[model samples]
Target: MLSTKRAKSVEVRSKPGRIYTVLTTLGREIAQGIIPAGAVLPPECDLESRLGVGRGVIREAIKTLSGKGLVSVRPRHGTRVLPRRDWSLLDRDVLNWLVGQENPDRELLLAVQEVRSIIEPAAAALAATRATKTDLLRINAALTAMEASDSQATATAADKAFHLAILDATHNPVLQGFRGAIDTILSAVFVVAVDSVDGWFDGNLPNHATIARAIEERDATKARDAMEQVLGYTQTHLSKPKAGTRRRAGRTGAGRTLSQT
Candidate 1:
């Protein structure tokens, strides 16, 4: 008679708090593009045995990542990474990890800026009309820091805080949902533009001030125009395609990874 253990049926055990490790390891693989998107993950029993973990731990880890838009689960389809577009760019942890990936592509960086152009100005206008006194104070404080800072990193920090404050002022979760993409765009745009301009703070403060003033006045059109100016400036210096470049895979940066969200 064949032993029962010889059958493929599996048992899952609950270890301590190590479930997070499995999640992170999977997250890192997702980030590094090691595992391509749309690939179905192994079954629970298979994954648990391969990862040397209990079924409970594997399930929890999968749930955590799934909620973050990193993985998808279907009864017949198993689990898969969502497409990059479906990824929650607003997730702070996800944003940080994506940015930290090696030599991320410039086109991807520019795409982030394009997404910002679509979302941020409207958010700013909304904030202008809706911001409370406390929100205004926070906005002013962030602007003050940016205006006073002489260093690139410090100024970028201030600029980032300023935008975040504007988003918070809107008090609309839908509007606020683009925070991670906004932050990524700001960071990458600053990195790119810093090379072409001297004293990045000095170069940008005028535009920032104009935008802030328009927001303070609750002038939606003016705010949008000012935002347009900022985007125009960025595109002028950073978004241009060189003469010899191809459509895709042309940029000499770490290329994009295709994955499920």
Candidate 2:
């Protein structure tokens, strides 16, 4: 029998390869609640046959799940799915799998926005007070890229970059760590927000410039206000339906062109 240390080492050093496939498929299922908490995973041999992988691969996959707090493995009993709270909620793959659910988790989305409301306003205020010329240049460059983007996809990416640039301007390591959580939700919300409102980016494109200009002027209050407006627009546009359109939570609409801006 392999020692626990040896098993973990093998799982980590080996290319994941087939194990990644199994982990993603099963991990997504677990994240989506298809395999609910407390359910027992299939026996090793059964998983091997079902997933078309060797015993070693099965063991490694189980170990991977264990590390994520998704399952608890035992010597006699089968691996049991742990409670959702026990899972590593911040793990990238776990979050991605959660994103795969047909109905995106609104609560989770709102939670991220709440954190943004708390962190970004302060970060923008600090940036306004402390940003150097080079920092301001990066922020303006991102704004320019956003304006020049040809497609909604490109615009969304540029929009994220603009905010990340502001975060970088703050120059505080502890606050910078908050970015990982924000990044996880930014894309999800951007896609959903654009889809929720007609010409969303067209109406909001100038708000990012508002933030950049305020920071350039070194007006802490204006910078904070501008960032709050940007986030407020995100919340309002995502939460409320378009004037004539009934609420379409997941519909992908034809977004307005950003190239003309």
Candidate 3:
């Protein structure tokens, strides 16, 4: 049973999207470790009283969390927070909850980068072989947006679009299906990287351009290499101390220049 204080901590006022509000509040607590694994949630009645939401809404929110592997609801056992290992880390909501925490999980962020390192280079290679003119245009347009972005928010969106455009160009339905997961993780990474590392967005533009140019020329090898180089810049930015640890460094200069083939 949740303590009275703890239950009150998550209380919600009636509003539109009440279910989503309840879901996010509870999910954020779980993700941020305020509610640790193995802790059983309060009974439905208690939650109903505390959150001021209908029982059905609470059930639905728990059901959705269960689908994300964040909880296990057993007959008579109540709902228990599942171990982090059991979470569907790539699920859009889960990733958002995790990375949106005040102190984002460093290990999880690195795992996102690792996933990108494994997938994006290969996707870029495939796009080089299969991307149509329209696909290339989308990629170039995203790059142009990144170059012109004056705010961190716009730069982050453009950066995500640039990567997503390459993934779409692969023309593999299975790969294309990863769009939601990829978009969420990229947003998380870009948000953190841009805030933490000076010139994270602008410094990586040349690498992104190399990827676009290689795909346009149908050079699979160059595209893959350029994509890897772009990811390397991400790795560097992610590895740096988070913002405010030190004075923001001078604009992170471009990394190893990718020679045009």
Cα lDDT tens digits for candidate 3, 158-200:
8778889999999999888778888877766655654574555
Q: All models: lDDT?
A: 0.68, 0.76, 0.80
The stretch of ten residues in a row with the least summed lDDT in candidate 2 is 242-251
Flag the better candidate by TM-score, 2 or 3.
Answer: 3
Per-residue lDDT tens digits of candidate 1, residues 1-261? 355654423332234456877887787677567777888777899988888887888898888879889899888888998877787766765665565444445676666667777777787778778888888888889889876664556666788888888889889998777776677667755554544433334555677777778778888778777766666666655555433422221112332211000
Off by over 4 Å in 3: 1-16, 243-261
Best-fitting candidate, scored by lDDT: 3
Best by TM-score: 3
Evaluated at residue 16, the lDDT of candidate 3 is: 36
TM-score for each candidate, following the candidate numbering: 0.70, 0.77, 0.85
State the RMSD for candidate 1: 9.7
Which ranges in model 1 have alpha carbons more than 4 Å from their true place? 1-21, 42-54, 74-78, 188-199, 240-261
lDDT by residue (tens digit), candidate 2, 1-261: 569889978756764788898888889888888989999987888888988888888887778989988999987888999998898776666767776354567666666677788899999999999899999999999999877676656776777788888988999997777666566667677545644656566677777788899999999999998888888877766666424533332224555523111
